[model samples]
Target: MVDTRIPHLPNEILYEIAGYVDDEDILNLRLSAKVFEYITNDRFATTFFGDRAYELSPEGLEALVKITEHSVFAPHIRTVVIGHGGKHSSAKYHDLLDQAFRNLAAHGNAISIGL
Candidate 1:
């Protein structure tokens, strides 16, 4: 249910509250109500690929690509951190990273990759 009280608050207050939480929480809050969605837009969200970036399963990589290409979330994503855990072959990680980079680039994101 949408909290009517939040939407009534000043936008400054709402954004101040949002700044106290992590990006994941902000994303969830944005989904909770229209008011939150508007407030969250000020800071956008960070999409962290977590610690297993190099160990992602095929399905995980597909999901990552999907999110990166999503029109709604794509614009809000301010950061994407894909790290290597050294458990996978270099070629596999490279392929995954390359695909992700392409998806992001196609969506107008500029990224720098370092080996």
Candidate 2:
């Protein structure tokens, strides 16, 4: 069973813990509680985008853009990953990414293309 009477964590330590997790984990942890959310939302609001740029199609692009454009994640993103897989023969994916980057850039974060 989960313990309900856990000791309170020190402020400095809790903020430090938020620095080590990947972006996805941050997203998960943010939803766990308001305290965790405030700490993480302040320290790790940005994400690298990683290779996740290749994982979307046109419709997916729209969805992805919409998700990131939300209030909680928009300003938190400081960096992004925008590289496409070489195995793709068609330029369609690249075009999709280009447009996505345009959308992502409009929000005022640093964009790392050719990632």
Candidate 3:
């Protein structure tokens, strides 16, 4: 049997390998081993959550709230894109937007918001 397990590689080597792969490949690598998950956490968070876009709806705001609450992912978020696609005058929509803005306000790392 060929001993080709990836976990046997040093963490430095694994990180180097991660740096060479694209986002989809990196996600697959994370699924392949726990070591990959541990080593690629920062890169994964930064790559996927650095700039986020969400629709101006309850569902989208909920997702944003969840991401903002995440300790690992929240800090990596630098910009947010809120699409104004739905009805703007609904009270529920305004409420969710208010809540989302509050959450984003608390996320000090977030620098820009696009509408």
Question: Pick by lDDT: which candidate is best?
Answer: 3
lDDT of each: 0.61, 0.57, 0.81
lDDT of 2 by residue, 1-115 (tens): 6544312566576676666767668877777666777787644544533223434445655655664566666555544444335544436666655655566677675644344
lDDT of 3: 0.81
TM-score of each: 0.51, 0.46, 0.77
| Predicted candidate 3 versus true structure: per-residue lDDT over 24-53, tens digit per residue | 788898998989999988989989998999
Q: Which ten residues in a row have the lowest lDDT in candidate 2?
A: 48-57
Candidate 1: tens digits of C-alpha lDDT, residues 17-97: 777878757778778779888776645534443111323556656666777766655544445554445554556655765
TM-score between candidate 2 and the true structure: 0.46
- Lowest summed lDDT across 10 adjacent residues in model 1 is found at 46-55
Evaluate model 3: give its TM-score: 0.77
Global lDDT for candidate 1? 0.61
Regions of candidate 2 where Cα sits further than 4 Å from its true position: 1-31, 47-52, 76-99
Quick one: ranking by TM-score, best first? 3, 1, 2
Residue 9 of model 1 has an lDDT of 79
